[model samples]
Target: MENFIYKITPSKLNGTVNVSGAKNSALRLLAASILTDRDVTLENNPNELLDVKIHVEMLEALGKNISIEADRILIKDESFNNELVWNKRSIRNTVLIAGALFARSGYASVPLPGGCQLGDRKIDIHLDIFEKFGAKINFETGETNDTLMLTKETELVGQDIHLPIRSTGATENSILIGSLAKGTTRIFNPHVRPEVLDLLDLVSKMGAKVEVFGQDYIQITGIGGQSTPITPIVHEVVPDNVEAITWLMMAIVNKSKMEIKNFPYAHLVVPMQFLLEGNSGISFDEASQTLSVDGKNATSFEIATGPYPGINSDMHPIFAAYGTFAMSNSVVTELRFFDRFQYLEEMAKLGANIVQDKNTITISGNIKVKSETVRATDLRGGMAVLMLLNEGTDTATITEAFQIERGYNNFVTKFNALGGKLEKVFPESTKEINVTKEALVA
Candidate 1:
């Protein structure tokens, strides 16, 4: 299907939704597994997302045996082909494999990856910093797909590598290489997101010594066990904080009582603190690892998004949608991703008074948005549109819903279970665009 057309009406969700496993965590773990021949079993993995699917296929092509279900994955990489056919469209996660592939077989070849348009997600940092540890790379930009071939001259020696910016992909590549390199490797200015922390923990179980000093520095002591056998351990993937925050918005905007299970509140303390400061009606039960939100005292709030342990740039749109119906103005400053407000125009269709200036967005609250046809441009932005639809007056249609499905698993089913008025209208089931155009002309 090209996209999903969501037919929605004004409704409040009063039930619960179990968030999916973190796509980020699962993919990185998959990459790190290449360093070992031991079987790796990951529980609570999010296999539904499109990105995860692509990575699974890529790993299979590398001669890894993978068995996947809805929430569990068992993978064993005893041997892999040195040559890999490349697809640029979903290159983001595959870039991490360079280090692990080199560690296992001393050779790595894959096409350059080109993924979503979230700015500054380049692989140059991964390539440049990996070279510091003795990985040789040849790059030639091609018209159809840029081919990248990587080989190791010798075993990677432990060294200190500094990143100008804390890019997540670069940090992960360094960790994968450090796990198999000689001596201790220190990474400066690493992006210490929860997913990264989970990856470090997983590798530690696999006999890689890893340490974190504060949020900016990560130290990993290499096993230096090239061609040596490794004992893999069972690891459960971390819960998805982004997905948790999305469902939290659902509970509040629908003005309903909801409970979210398996919520890792520590990883999400920063954004959750913002909601608390803003008087969002939510509370946590640490004993049970659940968050309870009622439809009471949903207040207006302002937040500034930064790196991890701070407000995430992904949370910008979800909160923008929630604050639109608040009692006052909710000002958002997106310091990380500037062009995240593309969905504001579609939001305005719901009678939301949202003003955008450069990287800042100011949303006027207490106004009831209209139920009208709008578009979901990106993953996070598409979710924001869904929250806006709940606060709308009547019916609404959300276009390009595949963007939402990219991250959310069982979106329509979960939303409907929570008393949400949502349905996916397939293009085949609905009127064809070409036929509709012809009818208009006639």
Candidate 2:
């Protein structure tokens, strides 16, 4: 198999761009599909994402019938397969898949979850949740891969699960398992994120009685042992707030004008406040569902990431890129993931001067970075590099370009639609291709 790379040329963004469906929300919906036996239809799904594609394959391996028509996905399962003999790489959503299967048949065997090297994302919390739900958990370690097995000797009994921390996966799994448990399950100290809310919206449409009382707790009344004959549902996914911010930052850094459609104004209250406070040229028209930016006032600012309704840890990299184009210095403190500085080294390849002291990073802006070969260590980190490269007037290669595809959907076409220059290049030999700046911009 030939591995391809992304070759980016200096280009300016203009015109309108539509936001795709949320990757985080869609994956959870796919896993939650198994909670009911009826066919579930999801609209506005970003099926182009590599992670979603891999998860679709995983669902098929478990005996679900999946059909993709344009941006919509229809999932149907006539007969459930509790065990998954997966041969391909698995995603972190497999944990949710286990919970759904346990709710269906009381037993599930799935390959261990695999995802980006984002610090220590342990599954101990998930195991604890399952154990609290009256299920026995075991880990079968193999030479090449490991498998997580869950079994229940009796019906799952609902109980109060108080999360030690605001972990998203643990909270989502609680809802999945609680939907079919014998009684009502209440989750205290849950991470009430937008994606979590989306999942709640989905399962509710499929006949799960879920109620939210602020951020304090969530209660789900299960359908008991009779898990079948669930109401078939059609739902539309929420827009990707992360991608919306990505386009906003990219247009501002490149000094371009862009109008973002399908904009989820409600989900971006905090991040947009920060941008407006920093004097970034931005305006939103709620009636039209459009956000327009001229990118004339891009400047340095300060920010710290936290949980939902705040700047996410994933948004830090791009915000760092946004600060990199300013005439003054910018500071960012990552309070969520302290060890996410692996992308800093790769950013330096493009002349980014970032100093790190523990979880805080000070980015010295006003430096013009030259085009150079860089690697995409993770999904968000890779997109940050692409935005930085777009701010330049030369050609650069991004090795391991597939990392970007895990989140952003149809990025190449969308970039070109906004007058940004990007090309997918497959190497014929070991030598790299060089293009003149004038030729690239022409």
Candidate 3:
């Protein structure tokens, strides 16, 4: 099968969705596990997602002994050879592995990382910080690919480093390398994402001296300490604010009531405000980490994506889907990922009046969609298309759903459990070329 179709029925959606662990945070934490000489265990980690699973596979391939039980993972960094280079397939997790390798071996050579096509994610900040800690870097860039060679001279000497931006990857790299430096290392303009803090906590647990002074400054005292085996501790992962926003938008689009459990309300302040501006009634229960949505009279709204504590670029695609059902026009300005508007073409096929200008998208209200085939350009785009299929259209076929499977574990099974009619089909069987013109004439 070349494509999969979702046969959806418009009905009231009820029940609780227990949010999964933070994929972003778990990936970094898994990298931190390699810093310990003894066995380290991580709880509430995202081991189910394909990205995380592949990272785990890479770790195992590099000769790390690991085991998983429930939401906890036990990783023993008994023996690892930094000489075991990573291929293109293994480079996807380079951001996390870079920090881990630097912490353990005092040197690392990671090829340029790969991720969604969100623009140029340069490594200048990472390299600058690494250099400040007495590491020299060599770059090998070609027409289609690049690799990095990092080496340390003597013990890394810590120094105060300032970053041009609050890049999460840069901050993580600094923390990982700085922890092993000889003196005090101070990082200014640091990113304060919860995921970064989680990594700091993990490093501190491994006997590293770390302190956060303010919003964008962190100080770490470098002093090598003994490594001890630590087992996984059970700590519930924070709910995905992006996914919660997607579900909330779904409720608003359908003008139906929805109660989202295990939602990280604090992390969704911006999205909540956006919903409020649309006149969608919302209530949150902090104790239960649940968000209730009542959109009987939902209106339209406008938003622009920003960094943390703002409308995230990651949520822009789903916002497009929800905007289609608004009572009035809605605009989503993607300030972060400039090329994200391409997915609107798929929405257009579903009869959504979406117009794109550079990084902005204007969505007309109340699109009457018809069943059609669409292709997911990326992970978030796939989810956006899936949400659009929830209503409006009778049957929508989606291609390149493998991108969605990379981030969402057993997505079809989960959607089916929620009464969503979706079937996965192979690409070859469902997609055909060169037959459309002849078939159309017939």
Give the TM-score of each candidate. 0.91, 0.94, 0.87
- The predictions' CA RMSDs to the true structure, in order, are 4.9, 5.5, 5.6
Residue-wise C-alpha lDDT for candidate 1, range 288-395, written one tens digit per residue: 898998866456887898888888787888889888868889899999777667788888877889888888888898877777888877778888887877777788
Clashing pairs in 1: 91-113, 350-369, 350-370
Winner by TM-score between candidate 2 and candidate 1: 2
Error of 2 at 218 (Å): 0.7
In model 3, pairs of residues that clash are 1-426, 1-427, 2-426, 2-427, 2-430
Worst 10 residues of 2 by lDDT: 433-442
TM-score of 1: 0.91
Q: Give the C-alpha miss distance for residue 291 in model 1, angstroms.
A: 0.9
Pairs with backbone N, CA or C atoms under 3 Å apart (clashes), candidate 2: none
User: Which order, best to worst by TM-score?
Assistant: 2, 1, 3
Shift in Å, residue 235, candidate 2: 0.6
lDDT minimum window of 10 residues, candidate 1: 433-442
lDDT of model 2 at position 191: 87
lDDT of 2 by residue, 1-442 (tens): 1246999998878999999999999999999998887899999999999889989988898889999998999999856789988755567888999999988789999978876767767789999999998888898875444789999976787889999988888999999998888789999999898899999998777666899987799999887765455567899999999999998888887778899998888998998876776555688999988999888756778889987888888899989988888879999999877877888999999999999999999999986877999998778899988888887768989997877988999999999999978998777773343322121110
Report how far off residue 349 is in candidate 1 (Å).
2.9
Sorting all predicted structures by lDDT, with the top scorer first, yields 2, 1, 3
Candidate 3 lDDT over 20-136, as tens digits, reads 667777777777766666577777666677667767876786678889876677887758865335443333457557656765687776656665555555567777777777667
